[model samples]
Structure formats: structure tokens, C-alpha cells
Target chain A: MTMTRIEVSKTYKLFINGAFPRTESGRSWPITGKAGDTFAHLCLASRKDLRDAIEAARAAQPKWQAATAYNRGQILYRMAEMMEGKRDELAQAISAVPNGPLAPARTKSAKRPASRTSSLRLSVSPSLSPAAEVSAAIDRLVYYAGWCDKYAQVLGCHNPVAGPYYNFTVPEATGVVAAVAPDQLPLLGLISLLAPALVPGNSTVVIASNTNPVPAAVLGEVFATSDLPAGVVNILTGKRDELLPHLAPHRDIDAIFAAGLSASEAQMLREGVAENLKRVQIHDVAAIAAGEQGQSLEHIRGGVEFKTIWHPALA
Target chain B: MTWRSPTVDTVMVGERAASFTKRSIKNATKRELLTLALSMLDLTTLEGKDSPEKVRGLCHKAMRPFERDEQMLGVRLPSCGAVCVYPSLVPTCVEALGTSRKVNIASVATGFPSGQYPLEIRLQDVRDAVNAGADEIDMVISRGQFLAGKFDEVAEEIRAVKRACQREDGSYAHLKVILETGELETLDNVRLASDIAIQAMDDVTPSGTGDGNIDFIKTSTGKVQPAATMAVTLVMLESIRDWYLKTGKLVGMKPAGGIRSAKQAVHYLVMVHEVMGPLHAGPGGSNPWLTPHYFRFGASTLCNDILRQLVRLKTGKYVAGYDFSEA
Candidate 1:
């Protein structure tokens, strides 16, 4: 008689300091499908996990920032290349969610031009299908990859001084950055939140989408193989509300970029600015998914510190 | 005096040591453990490039540890147990530490890291450090002599070093014998070295002088690979326990080097508590071995990590290494 084989299941762990580790709290929550069938388990990251990630980010930030801008661009492009190789698996994880982008009967809307005004809506506007979202996420990475070396040139400018001195302003990375991804379009939202801060050389610790974190966890695998330095980008999968309070008041986190937060959640993040005077940038999920608004020079500029220097005008 | 050192079960010792790390230390218990571990630190700087200014800075850090301890944790932290340095820097530590003496000054003498010098020079090294105002003297054993079956010579050298720790005031500077177990090659050798060192110190301790300071059997000199492993430390702790059981005398244990994390320090404390019993189980209502007086960690990088953990426990937020002083 032939025996039936047991299906092997995968455990989704947090990506911290470039390695996958179970939460120190040893707690886990389930990711259930539409019919309430549990498919996988993800670590319920605690405040300590956030703390550990920040330590790693702080340690890696200097060397990463010191790397030439062209080199950072190459690494970012590598991320996109790795993502393309895993496109099928990423699409599967995204479509596995209940009523996700791949649900039948979803109308395929005509592509909208990237704009800041249309992205201002708070509601969940019609999003692309799973395949399109995955492709868009990959493209978004490539988009930032090109900006890594050029963002400084476009954002910086020579100053007009009233003296015989040459002066100019350049943007510098704002140290470690903490981010929150949107619940809708998990992969696309994460890439949108990550690429801008990362392109500018700011190390990031991002809380993945609470409702659909499978894609973000899988993206960690891509990051590990992309030659991206460990701690450059750490991903945590747990309840956003539970992590926001800890993320906001963190003194080590130089800035915060969050998308798709409610009024109270946004308030929680803003209130923490008083503790460390960290920069807080909040955006809508729909806006982040709208490529034009999400991928822009201004987004990269938000997480940087502008430094002005003066030198003798004489040769 | 002849000694019979029992053989160690390497697998059993490793398994037992691994089990201590699995203890779920959390909440108030974790906070208490972190603070206790902080108090047991022997902030050390034994470098060839060590300067007077550097030793002074280390002494300052040893006394205060964190500048804003009371402001952040609402509890003033106890100063570190001692500051270990080269004998030449003993006077520098003395001046920087001032007369408050909250942090004792410990000096590594007898050709530390490697004890290759002649017996007379090594003993003189201990005397000079003790006279230079060091409250403790850390000496290294000649691994070559012990490994070559010359146990008697090794024991005689340790006894000579202990004698040199004596001062004009009749009180002796505490002696810590570094086994340099990394060179011992096996758990059995580590056990034998620990036993020989403890017995030699006990022999010269002057019986009925409960007033004599406690001596230590340390694991390494922070200069070798695999300086202090859990298994090696457990074997030494068991040796100390066996000595205590047979003679009713307390011998301190110091595991120097390679202990850089707060978690690892706590594991060492757990082994001490389990193998030797609770802190107050001894004859005088307290086990000095469990206290900083009998136990110490010769680790310099571990202080900031412990301070960071303590701050996290207090503020519910994680802090960065840059926030603390580099000393």
C-alpha cells in the first residue's frame, strides 16, 4: 500500500541584522486564509526585536553611508534583479490573501499617470492585480536604483552668497529610519516605503503589513541574497498598532516613514517626535501604490539632512 | 601536598552548561539579574598601548558606569567591582579612582597573558603591584610547566605569588590565579589546573585567619582564543564547589576574557548559583562566592551592553551604543 505524504510548512521569522531569527518573546501569530484555514505562522515581534534591529542598523549605517552613491545604486539594482527571479513566488504569496488583488471579477483599471493630487485619497482605490503589483514593486525598486547616485545632484544646489566665498548645499542620510508598510499591496507598499530612505543611505527597520505579511517575509529572502548589507533593511511581521508606540519614541531612530495609518495611529507617531525630535513622514496607502506619488525625489528628500558648506572662491 | 584531580565528563558538562542558558529570565527577574551582573564586572584595560590618560578614563567609568543612571532608572547603580590593568598603571588607577575607593584597583602582574618570566621576576612583579596600591593582583600560571607533569613547580610558583601579595599592613592583596585554560587543551586538564591553583592558594591562606582576603581561580587572561567557555567555567566552578565541600574554605572564581554580552554574564551567574547554592547559604548568612567579592567577570566591553539592557528595562525603549561613553 502507498502512503500519503505530509506537506511541509514554512515558518516566517523576522529579518533583523540581516539574519532570520524567531522573536525573543517566543510568541507567534497565525496567517489564516479566507475560509479561516491557517496557512503559515509569523513571529510576533516585540519591542526588544525593534531594539535589536535598531542596534544593527546603527552599526551598519556608517559603512553603508560611506559607500559611494554609485555603489549603493548598484546594490539597489541588485535587489530588483533578485526580486525578478522570485516573481512567481511573490505573486503567489500576495494572491493567497483573502479578497486580495488576485480575487476574480476585479476590473483592470487603465494605468493612471503618477501624480501627487490623485494619491491624496484615504480610501482603498482600485489596485493592480497580483502579477501587476509584483511587477510594479520590482519596477519601483529599479526606479529607486537609478536615483541613488542622481538624487543628490537634483536635490542639492550651489548657494548665492553675498561674499567672496563659494557655498553649496548637499543632502546627507538621516542615520537610522523606522518605517511602517500599508496593509494593502504588501510587496508594493513595502518597496515604496523602503526604497526612498534606502536610496539616500538611511538604514531602515520596517514593520511589515499586519494583515498580509507573507510577501514582506519572502522579500527578506530576496534581500539576504541581494548582497545588501545586513541590518541595512530589517523587516518585522506583527501587529502595527503594537509596534507603533515603541517605534515612535525610539531615541535611536533618526526618522520615521509610515504609510496607511489611521488618525490615532498617526497621532501616536507624531507624539513621539517630542522625545527625540525625530522626523515623522506619514502618507496614505493609495498614494504610495500610485507610482508617481510614491516614487519621487521629494520622498527621498524627506529622510535626509541638508548640509551647507563654504569654501574660498579663489582657485 | 599531593592532589588527586578527578576526570571530567565533557559531554555531561557541556549539556549541563547549555541547560543554564535556557532558563527563561524575564520581567523583574531579568532586571534584577542585569543589575547584579553589572555590579560583578571587573572593568579591564590590559593593552600594550594603554596610557595613563586611558587608565584614568577607565577608572572614571568604573566608578560611575552610566552618567544618568539615577535620572533614567530612578536607582543609583553600584560601581563596578574593580578595574584590572597592568602593574605600571596601578598608580594611575589609584590617582584617578581617588580616596573614595568605591571601585577597587586590580593589576595583572607576573607577566600576564603569558607567564614566561623567571620565578623571581614574576614574584617581584606581584610585590610591586601590591605596594603600588592595587587592592588585588591577577597572576598567570606557566602552562608549560603544568602540561609537562611538573605540577609541584606550578603550585610552588602560585604559592610564591600569593606570598608576595602580602603588605606591611598585615592585610594581603587578594590573589587571582589565571589558569589560561585555552592552552590546557582538555576539560580534564582545565579541572586539574583549577584544583592545583585553588589548593596552592589554600595552603598559604594561614589557617584560622578568617580575616584573610579571598583568593580566586580565574579561567583566562583575555589574550587567547576560546578564553572562557561555559563548559570550562563549569568545570572550574565544580572544582571550587568540591574544595568548599572538603575544606569549608571559600575560593573565588573569575572567568576573564571573551565574555562580552549581558546574556552570557547572567549564564555564568546561574552556574555559580546552582553549583554553589544560593547567595546566603554559606556559614555567615551569605555566600561570598556568589557576591562580587568572590565572583568577577574580567570583561571590559560588557559594561555598556549591561547598561543598555538596564536602560531598556527602565524606559521600555532600546538605546544605542553611541549614547554611552566609549570608555
Candidate 2:
């Protein structure tokens, strides 16, 4: 008879307001693998947890938005560096998911475009190797990091009006944003959704992928180790349906990025968003994963509000 | 005469306070505790930019905390215990809370947040606030004197301020001597200051004056860190409990600053119940120390948090920060 020692596993908790607090309700659900073996016990967050995250994001957004754009770019780049440092851990977590390595696309275009605004040729799909996915995520972060301080120059405009005025439209972060991660490509999907929202200095409260949340929970360390200020990117692990309804109608949340919501879930979110007139965006994650939906300025603009200022043209 | 201050074990005080946070409060019981905590708040605004308009806004908030969302919910929310402001701003609060005697007017005097001024001026500050229709005066003690081991001078100053809290017609305004525990440096100093204030107020206050006894012993001025930690408040509450045991007069306890949430406020309440419950039982086996007359929260933002909780309980929807106006 051979004796084997059991491996110790870490429990995942909700990240809110700069702290990893267990769910105030003290509820936990087992996250199972393909063979029906429990991988970990993730916190089953309640509505109160959602409320607390929103409050933290709202409180932190103003200060985050006030930072200089160059500084914001530096922090996003630091996140990319943190992700780079934790490559092996993230790859292992992503590969552990069942059916994680689907039919791998044979293309190897995981390189940064020579020109800014040139299309990124990332081989993003379920079959993409975990290393390639993590590589794409880091490059994608750097791609947005290069855009953070420069987006305003491209998106902003000085309009020629009939009157003597300095009329210009500038972009400002829409206060607090809520992002829902996709289940299939947890690591890449989370990074894609979060990079654009954070590029323009918006603080986000993310609902991590329910089925494969270890990748997202692993990214919590990425966020903490990076210089991203506390509460800028809070992550919660729970059932999407249980958390989405509360995040949808929250008046403090200015915009919601709920990817892969079903037709019914979409309708429910739209109805809830109407209560506060919040900006809601639903994305096709599969299309993005197939190299079709690489993030651009529009995804960045989606998390921002345009401010048109008219100053008197004085000599 | 020689003087002695009771010995305080910081480790014991901290351990006792930490035990209270472990008590489980939930569902209906949690909601009830939140409601009780809301009623004990001294909605404060002691800023250098204090204005009559600001004080009036705070008074309105103190009186009707959930006014913005009351009609939609069809539930009546309770008013806080008092509107606390600067001495010159007491008239504004008094006029703002006019005819609504349910909310008392409290003023922070004695060179508030920092008690560095001379005794005569400090006492005059207390007198001016009381004359301006303030029913309670929150006076800061001389931390410099207390730290220098001049316990006699510290005690005498509290007595003089208590005397100053008396009005012309023999009616007394309640006095709350602030220890500014953050500046006291150590838990032993915190305990000694609390003991000195309690003894001084007890000596000056007539025995068994019913509701007119030396009103409260407060924790901080809200301008310092380490303000109103459970350990500091536990030491103060223990001092009050001991005084009550000796003189049979219940003294209220107030922990101000850095206590912004309903959870922290309820923990303070639990500590009070465990420490002072036996001596201060009200009707229906309830701890009388939980009420505003025997306990109060010196807070500015706590009212809105409690209002949000109340509205959330009434309607299943959580209220946003914008739903409640600033105090």
C-alpha cells in the first residue's frame, strides 16, 4: 500500500475596497472540475457584497480619474508586468479547465503591430495555448497602455464653430464601471474587458467567470502586486445570474460591460439599466477570441463620457 | 492630598473589546440594531468652514435623515439624538431644529479637537454654547496637562466646564468631556484620563439628579487618527461602569470619529451591553444604556449610512450614495 499526502488548496474570497474579505454572508460553493472533483471553494457573494464593491469603486473612481494620464499608463503597464511575472501560474490555472485547449489555431501571429492603431493579430480562441493566451493578454495590456495617454489626442477635437469660441470635446471616464467576465476564455476575456475600462482611468468592479474562476482569482494577486490603487479593479467570484441583477440597476454604476448574457439575461439587464439610465454594452466574447474583436478606441470610448467645453477665445 | 489612578491592562482591554466583534448579528435582529444605532447619533459638523447654512443643512439631516426617500417607501424613519456644531453655529442649529425638541443641539467647545487654550477661555467657550440654546456641550480635555501627570488640574478643568454648562435659570446643559484618546498615546493614559474625567464629573455632579447627571464621556474630536478604537472605548466604558457601581449614577459613553458604518456602531453597542447592561436596564429587559440619553454616537456620516440601511431594509433595493444628501 502506498501513502499519499493531500495537497493544500487556497480558498478564494471576494475582493472589495482593497481587502480580500470573506463573504459577509459566509456562504461558499464548490467549484468542480471535469471529473467532478472539487478544485476550490469560491465565495458565493450576496447582494450586500455587490453593494459593497460598488461603493468602493464609486469612492475610488474620482481619485483614480484625477491621476495624470501618463501616470495611468504607467500603472496599466505595471499590471502587464505583473501578469508577465506570474505567467506560469496563470497558464497552469487556465490549462486546468476542462476542454480548455480546444482545436488550436495553427497561426502564430502573437506579435505587436508595427504601427499604432494597426490591427493586433492575436490567435485568440479556446484552443490557443495557455502560454499564447497569457502572452496575448500581456501584449493587449501594453497595447492599451500605449493608448492611455494618447487616446485623448485622437478622440478629442477642436470644432470650428460660427461664433468666437474655443469649443472642444474631451473624454472623461464614466464614473464607475461594472465588467462581467466570460466563462470560456477566463484569463484573456477578463484582461480584454478590464484593459479598455481601466485605460481611460475608469474604476471597475468585475464579476469573475463562474465556471472557471481560478484564473480570475489568480489575477487578484496581479492587481494587488501591480500599482493599481485599491478598489480600482475589484473582483467577485459567484454565479453570474446571482450577481448580475444587483450590478445591473445600481445607480452609482455609470456603465456596465456584461459580455455573453443570454437573451433573457440581456433583456433583464436592459430593464434594470433603464431604472437608472445606465449605459449597458453586451459583447460577443467568442468573436473577440477568434481575433475578430481586438479592442480599439471604441471599447475605450464605451467606458467614457464626452464633455464639450466652450471657452471664450481671448487674445 | 495624594492622588492615584486605577491600573489598566491594555492587553485585557483589547482582548475584551475583540470578543464583542465576534457576536453574530443578522436578519431581523441586525435590522433592529441598526434602527437603535441610528437614533443614538450626534450628527456632527465641526469644520473650520462651518456656516449657518451648513449647520441648518446638518440639522435638517439630523431631524429627517431619510427625507429624500421617505415617501416612496411609506415608512417613517427616526431622528438622530442631536445636531452637533461649533459654538457660534449653535444658534443656527437651534433655529433650524425649532419646535422639534426631540433633537438636541450639541456644541463642541473647549478649543475643540485640540484643547490647548487657557482654562478661562475654554470655560467661556462652553458658556457661550450653552447660552446659545445648546442642550449639550462637548468639551475637549487638556491632553498636555493629563500627559504631564497633572491629573489634579485636568480634573479641576472638567469640573469648571461642568459648572459652565449650567444655565441662568438653574437648568443644566449636559457636559461631554472629550479625552481625545488619540493624543493620549497609550491605553494606560486613555484609562487614566477616563478615570479622572469620571471622578471629577461625579464629584461635581449631585448624586441621583435623575436625567440631569453629568451627561457623557466622549472618545475623540474626530480630527485625529486612532480615534475611538474599540480598545480605547472599552477602557472608557469600563471606567463608566466602575463609577456607576460606586455612585449608582449612570454616565453615558460616546465614541466618535472613524466609526462610519453600521457594523462598527453595532459592535460598540454590543460592548456597551456586555459591560454596562446589569446596571442600566430599561423597560422590557432592554439595556437602557443603548438609548440616546445614556449613549450617543458622535458622528457626521453615520446618519446617512444608517438611513441607507433602513431604506434597504424597507425596500429590497439598496440606496445609492446620492440618494441621501450630505450633512
Best model per DockQ: 1
Error of 1 at A161 (Å): 6.4
Off by over 4 Å in 2: A1-49, A100-127, A159-162, B1-6, B185-189, B211-214, B280-286
- Model 2: lDDT of residue B162: 89
Tell me the docking grade of candidate 1. Answer: medium
TM-score of each: 0.91, 0.88
Q: Per-residue lDDT tens digits of candidate 1, residues A1-315? A: 988999877878999989999999999988886667886788999878887888899989998899899999999999999999999989988888753332112122423344732443455573778899999999999999999999999999999999989999999999999889877788898899899999889999999987789999999999999989999999988788688988877778999998776556666777778777889998877777776776898889988999999988985
Candidate 1: the clashing residue pairs are none
Angstrom error at residue B96, model 2: 2.5
Model 1, B179-266: lDDT tens per residue? 9999999999999999999888877885612876888989999999989999999999889888777877788889989999888988
| Candidate closest to the true structure, highest TM-score | 1
TM-score of chain B of each: 0.97, 0.95
Query: How well does candidate 2 score on lDDT at residue A204?
Result: 93
DockQ of each: 0.60, 0.40
